[model samples]
Target: MHGYANPARFLRLAKLLTAPLLIGGGLLAVAVLAWALAAAPAERLQGDSVKILFVHVPTAWLAMGGWSAIAIASLSELVWRHPLAGVAARAVALPGAVFAALCLATGSLWGRPAWGTWWVWDGRLTSMLVLLFLYLAYIALADAATRDGQGQSRIPAIFGLVGAVNIPIIHYSVLWWNSLHQPPSITAGKSEMAAPFLIGLMASTLAFSLLFGGVVLARMRAILADTQAEARLRRRAMNAADV
Candidate 1:
């Protein structure tokens, strides 16, 4: 892991794996989407509206997964001083934010038919909304810190740690309060979701996970290139100053 932290090694590995990662990620996404949207049967109750679960549930899961990644990266940056940690954290922000937005939108769409409302101030929904805000705040803070010659600042890292505290709150929102959203349909303790629905849901989750990794890898490559360019400019400036 530490050896790969060297940018050159990391870039070399990325280049080697890029083709397979993209191909596998693309194929998995397409297969899952097709199966989820077409092959999966409609819910007995929610009918076609239940199909929204394919998108909504997966996005919600990724929203949490992305935050967890950011938190781990932030921790590594603070403790292990991993050079790529900040890059990984920053790379995940926009995609996580986008997924969070999709979760909220799809949830609202699912809610309208199932709950007779387009929006609600229920605990689960509200907490998830806060999660979305946290992602946006993390991105904004990171962006500001990186700009204006404050690139080495710890503020964004601190913000990421603090924002991670909200992840549990979001996860337990349904359990902690009498909310509009139901408990996990498939759980070790109980299972409310039918077998076919569970299959589709799991497939969707796998697809989204692959897609998220692909996006993060692509973003990390871009960040690495930018970092290298900046380093080159700094070296040139130092050499000119010496002359």
Candidate 2:
């Protein structure tokens, strides 16, 4: 990890890995989605609406996973002074927020048919909404800190760490509260899903995970380049002032 602390090393790696991940992930996603939509049988109860699961589940997983990345990067920044940690956190914020929003939108669509309502203040849903708001807030705070020339500001890092508390709440919400949402279906070697659905879901998840990683790395590379350019301009200005 420390080896990646060098921006040049990291940028070279990001460049090499980005295209393969993006292309491979995109192909896998398209193929699995086609399979889920066309070949996979519908759920016994939900019928055709169950097809949404392939898209919704992956977005939901990535939403949580994205924030987890931010929290880890923030921790590294604060605790280890990892040089690229802030860049990593910034790189992930937008994608994470997008995924969270997608989760909310898709969940609402799924809920409308399954729960007979377009929206509900269920524990799991509500907590996930809060997670979206937290992402937006973090994005704003981080941007403000950066613009203020406090690039290494600990405020955003601290907030990132605190926001992680919501993750566990989101995970356990269904178990902890009376909700319309179902409990764990694929935990502890017990799965309610049949083989077809399970395979499709897993494939979609792997595809999205690859795509997400590529996006994060690409964004990190861009951020590093901008930071370097800014530093160079500042140095030139200081030298001109000295003259």
Candidate 3:
């Protein structure tokens, strides 16, 4: 991380990686989603609704994972004063919120047929909703700092750290409270899902995770470009005054 602290170094590497990550992720996502729709069999109970799992599960994972990235970046900014940390946290906020929203939307679509209603105040659902709100707060706080010309503030970082408390709650809510959501279908070393569904879902998850990384890198590069342009304009104004 410190090694790439220099914007030049980071830009060089990001430029090298950005295209591949996005292109490859896009191709893989197309393939897995196609496969899931065509090949993965319908569940006996859920029937064709199982198709939603590929998109829903991946988005759900990313919603939490994005916040995890923000929290880590926030910690870096606060503890190590990593110059890029706040920028990174900011870069991820929008995408993370997007995924969180997707998770909710997909869940509702699945629920309507599965549960006879669009939504319930199930523990998992409630916690995931809270995660979405946290994403909004972080984005607002971080954007406010940038707009204020304050060069970043501790508030966004602090909120990122504090907001992470919701992650575990989202993860464990199904277990902690009786809910419409099933128990963990997949876990470390073991999965209860049939082989084809398991494989397709994992493939979908991997593709989306790559997409998320590509997006973050792209956003970070854009932010750096904007900052550099602002600095150059400031220098030009100063030089004109000296003249």
Q: Candidate 2 residues 1-243, lDDT tens each?
A: 998898888888899999998898999999999988789998889988888888888998899988998999999999999999998999999989998998899888988889999889989999999999999999999999999877547999999999999999999999999999988778887889899989899999999888888888889888888999999999999999999
lDDT of each: 0.86, 0.91, 0.93
Error of 3 at 214 (Å): 0.6
Give the TM-score ranking, best first.
3, 2, 1
Q: Model 2 TM-score?
A: 0.97
- Residues 17-92 of candidate 1 have per-residue lDDT tens digits of 7667777767877887788677888777888888898889999989988998999999889889899999989999
Q: Candidate 3, which segments miss by more than 4 Å at Cα?
A: none
Work out candidate 3's RMSD over C-alphas: 1.0
Flag the better candidate by lDDT, 1 or 3: 3
Q: What's the TM for model 3? A: 0.97
Q: Decide which is better by TM-score, 1 or 3.
A: 3
TM-scores, all candidates, are: 0.93, 0.97, 0.97
Best by lDDT: 3
TM-score of candidate 1 on Cα atoms, chains taken together = 0.93
What stretches of model 2 exceed 4 Å from their correct place? none
Candidates sorted by lDDT, best first: 3, 2, 1
